[model samples]
Target: MADDKETAEALIADFQKSIKDAFAVFDHESNNTVDVREIGTIIRSLGCCPSEGELQEMLAEVEEEEPTGYIQLDKFLPMMTRVLLERKYRPQPEDVILRAFEVLDQTKKGYLTQEELTKYLTEEGEPFTQEEMEEMLSAAVDPEKNVILYKDFVTLMTVEDT
Candidate 1:
């Protein structure tokens, strides 16, 4: 449990740092934010091949109220993380765990809240002990959002196998 918590914390810290570094590049105006137009460039700089249209769509999905089309780091991080994860981890046949994730992330949101995951696990899917569920949630759930990032979920699954 300690190891899992440490791993989760490290992963989150790394994620935050990566987003900060990337956002700094396009935040040339130094307002600690980037315009929607620069998102494509940022994605490209991250070594991900997303189309202009795709980048536009992701910007549209930002949940915050950005009247000027300028998004802060918090709003931009999730979309960037999702794009990078999708690029890095393809849904191959060998990745059976991904099938389970797809079922939970029904909206294709690339993340799942604890409620969403617990609902499936408790009702329709394989049964888990209360302690087991708690442990999984502790290891994978993001403390800030109380949700599981798809990338973190993947890491949790991968780590469990080893």
Candidate 2:
């Protein structure tokens, strides 16, 4: 599995150029520093999907050392690199996510209803806590249809290998 994926250095190297470019945009004074508050915006610009708590954690890391509410390009790069390297932060393959849903669908429906998902996620192995269920449903479920909408979700969760 490791052999099939890009090396850590390679992944960081590929990500750095764009990260640098985006950082530059936020560094208004051209002083290699950007407002710490804007870090989340910069991160999201790169298609990074960090939750609010995660963003706060990342922000804390960048701000703790400086304590000036600003982060240098040098400082920001390493943190963003780690985010890119974290497996949980990376998007899964569309087919893989779709297949996982398919396995649970049981009735051959492409989507799972809220109750069906509530049962699976809450009652199954390593059950999700109520908070987790709410977070997932907010993202993946369709309120009108009361279904998981995995097909549309696959688009949001997967990145094409280029």
Candidate 2 per-residue lDDT, tens place, 5-123, comes to 65755767788888899999999999999998789889977877676687788887777554988888887898887776663344456888888889988988789888988999889
Q: Give the Cα lDDT of each candidate.
A: 0.70, 0.80
Off by over 4 Å in 2: 1-8, 91-162
TM-scores of the candidates in the order shown: 0.46, 0.52
Lowest-sum lDDT 10-residue window in model 2? 84-93
TM-score of 2: 0.52
Q: How big is the positional error of residue 46 in model 1, measured in Å on the Cα after superposition?
A: 2.1
Q: Write the per-residue lDDT of candidate 1 for residues 1-162, one digit (tens) a residue.
A: 999999977876676677779889989888879877677667666665444455567777873563676888877787677655455422233266776687768799889888878777777645666886898898889888878986666755552210
Clash pairs (backbone) in predicted model 1: none
Candidate 1 vs. true structure, TM-score: 0.46
Top-lDDT structure, candidate number: 2
